[model samples]
Target: MGIIRTTVITGLLGTSSAAAYLAARNPVISPLAANDPIWASKVFKKHNPSRNPVTQDVCIKRIPFSKIRPELLQNDGPLALEFCRGVWSGWGFAVQRRYLDFKWRGPETSQHLWTNEQLADSTYEKGTAITDHFEVVDKTPSAITVRCGDSPRNQALRPSDGLFEISATIDRQREEVELRLKSCLFSSQGKMDGVKGPMPSWMEELHQWYARIWAETGSWRLLK
Candidate 1:
């Protein structure tokens, strides 16, 4: 992640099918900036960037559809939206290795709210530089997509005008919900898949840990 390019980051957030991995050559990479296919799958596949010198570092994971939350489907307040935020914020705290400022931000629109921001001087990608801006870029009764505005990974690897749109999308189903996290760069050469390198096991573990917790326990917290 080097430079952020132009274009309003289409597919900023979307549902899943793959899991993209973005890690440095060194192991034990930061959890936040590690491999996240939800957003990565959408960015790469939707954008279908070119791989000149670097091969697209991509991975996708498809969650088996599950039952949908009634309140979420009924346009009941902002619980549906907040659910997405909770999943993301949870990861932020883990990545930053700090929880002092990972409080809830409600939501983006007044529809009750769902999003969060923190300037934790986090060690991870965007968390390292900017106050992570995880906003609901797109949404509906069934799905919501969130994007990070100032990810460190994007600014570090992309070429001049090269930018990364790292985001995640949550889709609700009658009995099957799915999540897709992704990271992709838009450079002078179009969309770049990822920096050339395999995501480390340690770094991968960190992300996996957060995701598992989010899917298992975190969702319940948001339900309340």
Candidate 2:
């Protein structure tokens, strides 16, 4: 195991607000945009453009996508994402993301530079593990898209076809967002080959569950 992996294991399993996410009480989140054709039509596809590429469509109902702060959706920001990283523990996996660097090329460009400090997790810790590096591939007041690259640790292991990507967006005119995720083991091997699968249904359910917790944090959520 790497020093980075060893150091974050505990953090992944536990946090100061570990129990906060499990709390029963929460704020009222708007219902999914049942009538918004724009949101209904939006789709998420795997970034690894291979012959057999994987695609996923995420329509989050637990928390409205519009609820996501545009500022927090960028590749890097003033805030540290505070959502429960341990939400996946029930699935026998753990996840955490910490920013390494943030840069803006210029005022004239929408491109922003971002580096992730940590992307190790137990889900792919075996010979199939992967790392994460992200860039703001696209951005709008309504959306942010990011792509994940192999970490040095990952390339040493699954070097041949380890890559990933994700995009998240909310419509001011809708409730749910289209979340494109290919960052974990669920699709690592298939990333470059374009034979990947979407994150499982259970994982999606857990994300909604965690979204409830993240939503409850209110103004204290997803901010610096």
By TM-score, who's the top model here? 1
Residue 64 of model 2, lDDT score: 57
Report lDDT per candidate: 0.33, 0.32
Native-structure RMSD, model 1: 12.6
**Candidates' RMSD to native:** 12.6, 11.8
Q: Can you tell me which runs of candidate 1 are displaced by over 4 Å?
A: 1-48, 51-69, 75-80, 88-130, 133-142, 146-197
Model 1 over residues 33-130: C-alpha lDDT tens digits?
A: 44544335443333234532221222222232334445444442344444544544554234332321243222321221222453211112312223
Best by lDDT: 1
TM-score of every candidate relative to the true structure: 0.38, 0.33
lDDT tens readout by residue for model 2, 19-135: 354333332222223353322232222333232332233322234545556665454222122221122222212233232222222343222221121221222221322223333
Q: What lDDT does model 1 reach?
A: 0.33
